[model samples]
Target: MTVASPLRFPDTASAPTMTKRGWWLVVMNILLPGSAQVLAGNRKLGRVGIVATLVLWLLAILTLLTYLIWPSTVYTLFTQTFSLLVVQILLVAYAALWVVLTLDTLRLVRLVKAAPNARAWIAAFSVVVLIGLTCTAGYASVVAGSARGALGDIFSSGPSQPPVDGHYNIMLLGGDAGPDREGLRPDSMSVVSIDAETGQAVTIGLPRDLNPVPFPTDSPLHSLYPDGYGYEDRCDVDVCQLNSIYTEVSLYKPELYPQAEKQHSDPGIESMRDALEGATGLKIQYYVLIDMQGFADLIDSLGGVDVTVSEKLPIGGDENLNGVIDWIEPGKQHLNGYYAQWYARSRHGTSDYDRMARQRQLQDAILKQVNPVNVVSKFQGIADAGTQVVKTDIPQSMLGYFVDLGMKTRKLPVKQLELVPPTIDPANPDYSQIHQLVQEALAPATPTPTSSK
Candidate 1:
């Protein structure tokens, strides 16, 4: 008679036990999104997760290696443009992934408990393998990322430089015409200085037309759409328009655009700095850019800024271009981002000098609006949003330290000046006189007009 073999029977007493592999697989799947599927014998699902993980890791590696190498990637990820939105999406994805992994872990545990014998052993083996792989992946990532960097690495991992003590002056150059705008101007030039001991931050703005022609520099003429070509370099820099820097870098010199930004300059900041320092006799230490878009966003992010009209501001436009001639009388008023941008860029407000005054006032507005409370609260949001926009010589790692310093000893009142006709005769700018004035100005006394008549 065909009888069921005693040993082949489904005996509850002989319930199978889990092995290291099974647990390993469960842990692996739990760590990422779908790693466990591979251990569970789901070839297709395992492949997808494996591929995705590899890609994510690759990007993470690239992010690290060049952390201090360039600001383009970080800038694109952290600014007010469309990239900010993408950062937000990634953030959400990260959160969702976390939740999914937690749920998955619980499910895996349940499955492992119910399984017996070979299945349990398989699961355990998977878990162990996964753990090993995970550790290996993590070590590889850290080593690669450390070698490369993510963001903080940029600042934290740079060669040490000498201190700026003797009449140290720097410039902030804001360009308008990117690679797209051919004959754009550099209307935003702020001469900045600080005393290491006194801890002061000083700035003065200039009109784009004030110089009419900046000392020549490379042109930005193309867009290197790296988003399209993974390992491809197609961007070029044509110094046709300052605003067009992005297009030029994106198009012609995409390779050099990012590398040059960090190592040196093609649309040279050094050249710009030399010209500025040469004109004003101030030693240029650092240079940074607050692009047009970022300028507007930063202002808006602070919910606009507060400024008192120092004089009657005639807000009107040409016969056709349009003007706001409401004549804002001198008083305290809250300005929106767009309005602030216009005010900072406006030359028709009386004279070009008045626009400089507006720029300093706006800078004050920014300092006032941002406080420890605001900064801490908005840190993550800012990190996510600004990862794509702001480009500076400064790196990410050092920001927190400086931010802490700022919180401790903040700039209560920004030391500011608008280089005027009497002190700054643009027709024939007197560099030596301006330099001496700046040196003296940093010593506590208010700066007097040093313009060459």
Candidate 2:
């Protein structure tokens, strides 16, 4: 019998086989974490990874379904503090697990045993995948944490408020607290009345100079200014305007809004809310105060805005103290933060009504430009700027509802009624007539009856 050659099996795979194995291991790890270990390396570790991956898949499917069925609930999860914290923790944990599995898969690849030409390729591919996976998960984790911080810093932890008269009326106040100003004064005031069911909205703009603003019968300030806000015989225009309510009440009549502090609000805001409610005949549920000083930062973070400049507007320099430093010329122009701010605020040669129209136009431009892609791309900058720019009494609990309402409002045409000029004299507004106009603007269009054939 021929001397039986001592049967020998190859201890390491052949070059081509090793190359294919290396590629397959990396691919398997990506498609199904821990699968590489089960195929050749550590079975126990691979089983755990497989289980985790399965759980992850199930969770992903469940989350998608929830978002599709009840988007508000999903929004609530992302907005609430406790839920956001939980999400951040889970994201971090998932990121760590992914990193571990990717490393293990690389170890199992045994790149040294691969073909010399294929070794570099396999190693490079694995590294790129590792860095890509690690960075994506890591970035997502950071984003979740940032959102949690922003929500906690920006939104109040107050109780949810109900809509009044089938409408959720929110007061948007643009406060102009310049370096030369004495105190914070709301330069722009608008009540956004949104239909609770349809999300149809009507913006009722109140000029800052509107005098003798009325207060609701239930408001404590009503007793003090029964005739209306700044109704005294020799009332000063600067002190008696609608925007002055905030500073006036906060400084001299804090006692009028005793419950403001408890409700996460200041006396000034409550006073303004009360005055606007009385003026517009709409129950204001929430107030968002935008500091005009920080408005430029917000616009910049959104990559600037496109606005139509009807005439040349001054950028800087006081009209009395010094002439305009620069001018924003007419026609459709893309303006950065500084110019956009001036576009909405320049009052050197323009009337308050002109400024109001520009403000409204700027607002519409922002609404039109703020798509999901822009928001996601510049999320970090926007979040940072938002915290410094906005102050609101809208509670975190109700954010989900508002977000849903906002989405609906975006799809519909926004109706506006500025309390100025021929429509309603801002200098001496007729309270009853203002109420009637508001009703007409908010009323759903009645379908014309079809004529019978």
RMSD of 2: 4.1
Report the error of model 2 at residue 400, Å: 1.3
| Residue 68 in model 2: lDDT | 97
Q: Local error of candidate 2 at 58, Å? A: 1.6
Question: What lDDT does model 2 reach?
Answer: 0.83
In candidate 2, what are the lDDT values of residues 181-215, reduced to their tens digit? 77888888899999998889888888888887899
**TM-score (all chains, Cα) for each model:** 0.52, 0.94
Q: How many backbone clashes can be found in candidate 2?
A: 1
TM-score of 1: 0.52
Q: What lDDT does model 1 reach?
A: 0.51
- Find the candidate with the highest lDDT and give its number: 2
Q: What are the per-residue Cα lDDT tens digits for candidate 1 across 129-171?
A: 5455555444433333332322442232334233366333556
lDDT for position 390 in model 2:
90
Count steric clashes of candidate 1: 81
